[model samples]
Target chain A: MTERWKRTLVAAALGLALLLPGGGIARADSWQDRVSAGSAAATARGTTIEIAMLDRVTGQYRDNGPAAHTRIESASVMKVFIAEHVLHQRDLGKKAVTQTDLADMSRMLRASENAPANRLWVAYGANGIIADIKARYGLTETGPTSNTRYWGNTMITAHDMVVFYQRLMDGSGGLSARSRDWIVEQLRQSVEWGDGGRQFFGLRDGLPREQVISQKQGWMCCVNGHIYRHTSGYAGPDNRFIVVVLTREPSGRGGAHIEASITAAVRAMFPEGLVPRVQGQIGEMWVRSGGHRGPLGLPNTDEIPVRGGAVQYFQGGGAYWSPATGPHWVIGSILQRYRAMGYETGRLGYPTSDEIALPGGALSRFQGGYVYWSPATGAHAVMQPILAAYAAQKWETGRLRYPTSGEIALPGGGVMNRFQGGHVYWSSRTGAHWVIGSILGVYKAQGYQAGPLGYPLTDEVALAGGAVSHFEGGSVYWSPGRGAHALRGALLEAYQAQGAERGSLGYPVSDAYAAADGTRMDFQGGSLTVPSASSTTTTTAPPAAPAPGAPTGAGTATAPVAPSDGAATGGDAQP
Target chain B: MRPLRPAVAAALVLLAATGCTDAPPAARSDGPAPATSSSSGPAPAPPAGEEEAQALAPLPDGVATGTAVLVYSGLGELREPFAGQCSHDGSTTRIEGTADTARIVLEVTPDGARIDLDDGGVRSSSELSAGRYEVSGGHLSLRADMTQDGESTGTAELEIDCGG
Candidate 1:
């Protein structure tokens, strides 16, 4: 299996390198080629790929695609859902699933026991299971076949499976950030072992120590003359970016082969810098918050006060995502690329940049989230759409990536290619219509030398739209005012606000005065009062609160916020 | 009502707006009191910042207050019920378990505070742990701890309000 990975990487290295002639920009073909190669070489025959990439940064989905809607089979990946759903219900003031339910899920997922799966299925029943899925999971294409009927032709598709994994990973809904955190801790804390299945190295290989991958494997010896095997889980942070591969009619070592292949294929998308790079080896990690992340890798702090979260960095050491350690961790892991991209750290109130990645393609980028590209081979780039907020730009376009930054030089070219109202105006030496930002698009096609007609889209809305752009060799573009937009989602919000462009909004903008194609967005402060039946657009700036007396150093903030009798309520508790 | 001319009317209107009960008092009720505690910071804010100090005050009929879910995020939600019950009984009051999700125990005294919670019921023995919580209406807040004892064990918060 390891040899297969080496072969693909070696093959890809030679062919893919020249594909992306420019050092930074990636060609989309590279990503697809890597996926195709891993699928073909790693798994012998029937195995297929089912991937669902979420942009946690934007809380939007880049590509649900065909597999997203299909109902194939939950297999072990369903365990994550069961674990999260069971726990969320408990937090929502609903009765906690009985220890019996937990034990059943644990045995089924943590232990890969069919018996416990069956027991829980019977106990929860179809309606019971479906209710939790709908309520806690917000799943669109999933329902129970009944506890008794579970595994009785039980089926789920790769796409729906991805959603389930994502939902399990994201517990922010109806739950505190800490709540979802505990779930992540649980997923990571538990791992399956014994029976030579331990060192399988399928999910373990490829990434760094931060990813405490928790997955389930299934082997089916059909009644007829056939055999099938499947495996799925979050190959990276939060298990939201799920990868599932299934192969039928395989050889004796089918489980191991398929398992290893799926990891490789997905890992190709993760690249090097994407996954949380846990500092130190396992057991030596500095795990914080979710100290009790049993088996699911969800956050759950025991005894110690949960650090309302931490300043996460995509570094090697620390707690959460520090798979080297046990379940003790919380806040988010660091996405080292965030700082490299030039985003100000300690802002956004997030603990780590680990889950943050540069959007992969049009769909992924517009999905509005952060993504990470390996500073190394750049073979893969993992994306996590922001939940509601997004980064319009990487903290910096060029400042050299971390650790190895000292060795390489970053051009620091502004990541954004200026376009007028969705029309390309600057940057890109090639195509008449340039593709920039985290997406690719046909710009106005009008080469401008400057002034009005030359600047047809100068502040004017470009009839063309904008999207997060993806290239042939896996390179992603981040453009806000271009021929790309999120249609309507968090990615659009992020791209417009944090796009790598100099003038992009540093913070998320609530309202935008979008022009014809929406590529042009500006804060009018108030509604744009377009004349009746007229084509011209006019807007008035919203009235601003009179600025407080410019602070003369001794700005005296009254104690309307009284001190907390020494406890220090952080003074937010105004009676 | 007709204004007795522009000048008088302006004065009256200003008085009315500022005088209405919905707004906070326009001026300091009394001069700052001498420091009541060692860490002097304006005499402990006249003890009016948190509503608990007014526990003995009576309310008009039909105007009872309790915490409610005033705002909600689409997939997000948070709720905090005020300390109507706790205020009347000093800094401690046992809830009948409206079964709120914050999973906290509210306590107040003169000095520090203590909050206790075992995320997801995954408890262990440890020393002091840092936590986030809110306290308003003279009631201590459990800073949105998001976990549950998936088993039967419940998590608790120990808050030490001032007025110890």
Candidate 2:
């Protein structure tokens, strides 16, 4: 076979190599033949750990067979099915994306929003997501169901996962080749879960970055005695090798053993197995052995206790509370929240129910605790484990939308930062001192977070932003700025203010931030937000530029608003 | 298909004459020009960088990448290598459909153009040429081509507003 085809075969071999419970690289026969005999591997494992792989080069499929139908929870793997179904419509010209559609899909794929996936499900049902895969790429066994038995009802077997990946690669996923490439790219780019639920240990475990592995994992404490760990991913230069693993019982702590086993098996199957492994994304043994963890005898990471069944049990209404801290659903401290989310370390922004002091011993209210999900809006739980957003939505639930205001106890003393509009306000006890930032959806600032998060608005703070008010950065900074009304009113003022310009782009784009001497900062990949502190900043983009056009700047000067959240405006849908 | 080539070649010549100096880009984001009717055929591409040069511009909301679905007129017929100084006298148009709305504009210059949509927000642009252009609901059929036709080259089924 040609080198290209041979490499494809090698990648596929690695995915299936791990199917054998005790079968390390040396023992597994030609990986192709072994994988082709999917049913053998199904019964081959002690506990029946069936793994299926797809070779994108050829439309042919490999399934560990009926074992894939035992119907494991689809978990986040469902997101792939949803994406395929949606893209299929896009390719067939059966649907047009709305602003909401893009945003929803983005959250589903990038953030793995469960509710949003459901919304898209209406149009792209299993028949659609699955049928498209089968029709286009000849994918079989990866079917869609209204719900799964596992976490939040999204489940599929190891065999099915491979089938889905197969469909994604060969146009059977229902998306155009270009769309398939995009989906693969997004899955590959993901390092950690946007929702903090990335417990799957397959790809990140035993691979190299150059040979990026795109995968997702699902974990839930099963009542049946097994802590299930299900995962699926694509590996390769062109994402030719697809692997899926669904475990009946998981190893202790974070299911790392399951991941390690898969990783060890995959590692041996490639490079060392006479597969002319490309230099890309290969496991570097020295790197693995080179480093030691931390001074505390703990791996360089903090030993944050894992609240295992918190989201799993309470995903149905999980309440969280520490022994010392009583009766609270979320962990209040920012740093503590990250630890709660399984991160030994993370950025700040966790909410503690107890009052704690800030950088300067200021007491700020931090309530606004609530679990919000909307088929209309994505799911969000702004309380503990640090205020993180989830891929949830308001289906039959009420649209309280983040209780609006609340208070939290900080560490060490009185309080930390005040909270409002999705930001922490550093305020002195005196009313005169306060700094709020990156407010959600530009509403008039509610004066200051005097009351709690859900404080009833007597008359709606004379806030800024909306069809009317227009402010530069995210905060109210100057008079030259258009009032919320000015923004929505005349075309001139409207043209000057850029709204939603600073939200996170799924990827980087051409951005120009002016420096002190008019030296514009132009770089790639990093995201920039208007300092919640700035007022007179201006950004210029072509309101009339067309395709195939040369580029530049000149005319009317306008400054656009940056989104408080780190997401771009366009995204995919969950439903 | 071959029978239409001669006419297509002749049409190309005519298009080049009128369209050589000015043409829109591949797709527009500011909606259609004032002169364009709602039912008018797809707009042409305005020149690149023309929008910012013409109007001081607002910071772009974001940049998006897309393939060229259709090239109706003007620059649509040219093979210029991504660099051509173009301004408009109405020979081509750049039309595009976003998540919610469709845009049409003209390239008054290589850097900017006069937009006629609710173009009051931060917007962006791109350059693409390929893919079949399909715009239904209007009356007009034009073939894809090469020869340069003078002024507003390809036949766009635009209604004549004589009252103006």
Candidate 3:
């Protein structure tokens, strides 16, 4: 067989494997298949239904067709927007909600009462409420009717409705926690009959009784010879999923017929009468982990299958499961670091252990490495040689401290990881070594591994006053009075000729700077100047015109200049 | 498809007994009513007798009060009567009433009359066939064919007097 055909066959096999239990990845086509079936059922009923659902956990959004984006009159669904706005205002202290107002709001939501809605609509400025709701929720295809008298005519799309519900439930819709809870509570308390008519249809009736749902229903008739029926809400375990279904049928059909069609569509979409699953071992673990209140929080997504295992996300963390490893929860910063490293797909692979707290931070061991996090350094993964070097320093409690950055690859085939105190750079040639303190600063100023200094040949060594470190291209020296500076090429030879740090030149106080003629370096005892060509060196005393080939204000060198080719000219004058 | 002649003859006999002129209701109260009549037919003519005497007879004045009964038998069955009032301003007679959740209004003239009815969530309006009318002893009654929502239902009758 051709290579392409062979690859396709293997891929098909793997896809089938993922469908089996203990397959870590989620079924990608489940929602799509259900949506297609539901759409067909709705069409067969002679009604057009638009559906949009969002799995808050996985952040997966699904729509059956273009109807999801199509605008339809909101009918009584607009009342929810009005209620949210009013409650939001009350939360902001802009509106004082009295007992009467609350009662009316409850009646408005519970029974779909028109009188209360009418009162609130006029009081709140009908169009203004819709505009605020649209803007706050980022509803692209929603707007108030031109005639404010008809609040029910506000236009909305199924997709936008789902987004609104998600945000409202997820605490991102700008409603205070109390307000959101109140609104959700009201929706949950919805009765079978509303002030306008019977409304206990759609998602509420279609889904199983075991599935808890907080919903809003809307219906209106005889507009453009069509009747509108809409049902939307949060559903499933912990209300982790948002479902919105909007439909319009010919006005000649009775409300009961239209309502039944909507219910049929919903039933088709969830034949098993459930939203995304959160049951089995994962459900038990979620409960043990404190469910919605735990560090893992509520499941944001259904259990998703990955290679060899399945993973599920929660509000605060994630849960990973494998047949070999069972199920474990990774929380907080460690979880974030794992995700950044591509979760199980990356080198870190699946986590092998839950977070283990150390003296200064916490860590989670993964198949490939360990992610460590501390209040001071956030989180970073340490692997292989670097990890060994970190262990040598005693981890977070050691001198190296917690890692502040993950392994960063250098231009050449080397890797470097940053820590609170210093860095551990690793390569095949250099293995792994720590660079710390002032000596490490001078090394970094030269561009770390990519700079002319290349890799560090040795760790910092103690001197009489300070320390020094040697690099591939040169060495950096430090002293109590001179800080640190790099010396290389002819400059290094000249410094050695003058007895190096113990000589009259002492330790380099500043790196090389560009002279009018060549390069110059300042030291504690004196300055070294190298002319670019064979030129006469004249030393002019204090505040005098600079030498013909000398740079003006040359002693305050901030950075190293490229080494000149000419021979060095030593000077005894202090800078 | 009831014959129109019989209804017209009954109206003429009532007019002759009341000793009232065959002038349009609007002409007596304010100004002449429009020449248009209900789809049913035109009003009946008076017998040629005592025209001068009929002209000398005093015309009914001011507002008339009464009760209106409506029987609907289309989609469902409903029978209701509303205490009502009517006023004449030479050009036309406007009658209105409300009972329970239903309301009705009839605008009448010598040529024709139209009715607007709102009841049991159904709102409809249609013209009424030219009806027989009697005015005597401070009492007036009108019986006319009725239709609702564009479908013929039955008939509506009103009996009242010019008490106030």
Candidate 4:
């Protein structure tokens, strides 16, 4: 009947629709399968390929066979180890690296210059360099060539390279942060034209720009009748992942052919680039909603499982999925509110609908409640008996307006909500009712519900001459002729004994106040005074006959009944 | 000078016919070539540098003498003549030679021989067919066509004495 109810029903229907069989969008392939298949296809091309991938966040490592541990010629990749050893020495102040040394290091890293590598290799003995790096990085299968004169002959395995990179990134490789970052920065600036030849093969050319690659490449021919092409690097945000591809093709393959083979292998592993793919039902919904460029933005993490289904956080928001709810995204302030309420484990449960736009703001519905947001009021949850009361009053369109805060517990086992228009109070004894206008002002003057007025028992009722709202202690009456006032305790009893509003003393025009004698209430016809509480007296015009057609007892004011099921019935009402 | 043996004269004729007349003698060899003598007491010892070069070679067997000529145009122009010994254990023969800083290692198998050439800093590898071999005067010579990236780049000529 109300706008809130209509929106809730619509959300419920959409949630139900998401639960149908095959409701999820279809995807061509999962990322894991695609990467596995791609790796296999590349290996089948007559190259002995070894791959190692490390997820920095999860500390999970993946590889495509024992070749990751099989040592091959390091080629120019040995330059990285050489650089690390030199930098570590520099870090310890054991060696003063001059500006010339820095320039040479940069040349060696960015351009893969052999002269600089050879110079550094001799300066820091080849055996010492290998020994230092091996001990520092715990490389199990990396060693110097028997003839240390040929730095390119240093043997290294993909697994050891990954471990070296991981240690370098985590600042445990005996290099200071400055040294580590410098090395990584030089790698990031690697040029396509290195001293040996084209360097932008494999990860650099194969992966998308989204991967943010920083790499070192190695290529050398006819070491034991095999040509080695290796690409190793940091990929993804903040270098959150490491990828190493080591390949050795039979001798005599052209440089371009070998490089392309490595690149194809890398491309196969990451068809969608290096940003982890969002897959399955969540991925389908993401595409439907515009994919990486959509409102959800790019997925910052892989789909992670929760209690019921899974959730994947994107740059824009988090997409949550469940068998019952399909997929839905909660964004902005509403998402913050839901998180504060404990996410899916909280009272609100999983989102049943995507954020729904309203005239002034937006709302997202959940199993237990709704998180509503407005430019002026931020976001807050609305649930249960209070929601029903708000729905009966037509939600935000009614007098209560938008809720300013979530349900807050009172000291006396009651709950209260502050709204733009007024306040909603709920207690087991008093049900749920809103206090607003001048009567609320008078109740505030009497210390609100916490004072003698207690909780509101009924909403304001319109009388022939004024309005009235009953509270636990007494009642507040409002009239244009005498303003609003509260009548309570002994004074209220004395006024009722003289027939209350139907008696000679009409609706109270002034709240009960402390006088020189005791507490007093001023009415239109007369006043009721309780001096010292022991006795109370009412002065009025001669007991006038009840006004013709005047109602008796508590008038027509009725308290809002709490919902039987206690389920939220409105889109934006607070509990 | 002592007269050339008939086998050596015939091998020289074969070498000239095969466009190897320009092949230079071992200029950087450890010693002068041994003179031919009529007496059959014992043979002379080989050059001094040959023993060290043979030890350094990545060969499976003992040393053998060889003359190597490599002509390649890929990466950069390389036309070099190296007089050195080759080595073979049994199945594979490795002929490694260096002219100044440029070096080339040719590994010959029954199927094919692979040439790993490094002319200064520019390097390239190419596979060549198992060449035609001729043995005369206790010397064996191999002539093969070298192909790189599936394209014929040049030819490699090697003559070695493996004591067969």
Top lDDT prediction, candidate number: 4
- Displacement of residue A502 (Cα, Å) in model 2 is 99
Q: Among these predicted structures, which one has the highest DockQ?
A: 4
Clash statistics: count for each candidate: 144, 143, 17, 0
- Position A258, candidate 1: lDDT: 47
Q: Which stretches of candidate 4 lie over 4 Å from their true place?
A: A1-38, A44-46, A91-96, A146-149, A222-225, A251-261, A264-272, A276-295, A300-313, A319-329, A332-368, A371-381, A387-575, B1-164
Ranking by lDDT: 4, 3, 2, 1
- Stretches of model 3 off by over 4 angstroms after superposition: A1-28, A278-575, B1-164
- Per-residue lDDT tens digits for candidate 2, residues A283-319, read 1111122111111111211112334211111111112
Give the Å error, residue A53, model 4.
2.9
What are the interface RMSDs of all the models? 23.7, 27.2, 16.3, 18.8
* Kept native contacts, fraction for each prediction: 0.00, 0.00, 0.00, 0.05
Docking band of candidate 1? incorrect
Q: What is the DockQ of candidate 4?
A: 0.03
lDDT, model 4, position A536: 50
For each candidate in the order shown, give its overall lDDT on alpha carbons: 0.33, 0.36, 0.68, 0.69
Quality class of the docking in candidate 2, CAPRI style: incorrect
A238-267, model 3: which lDDT tens digit per residue? 777788888888766656667778888888
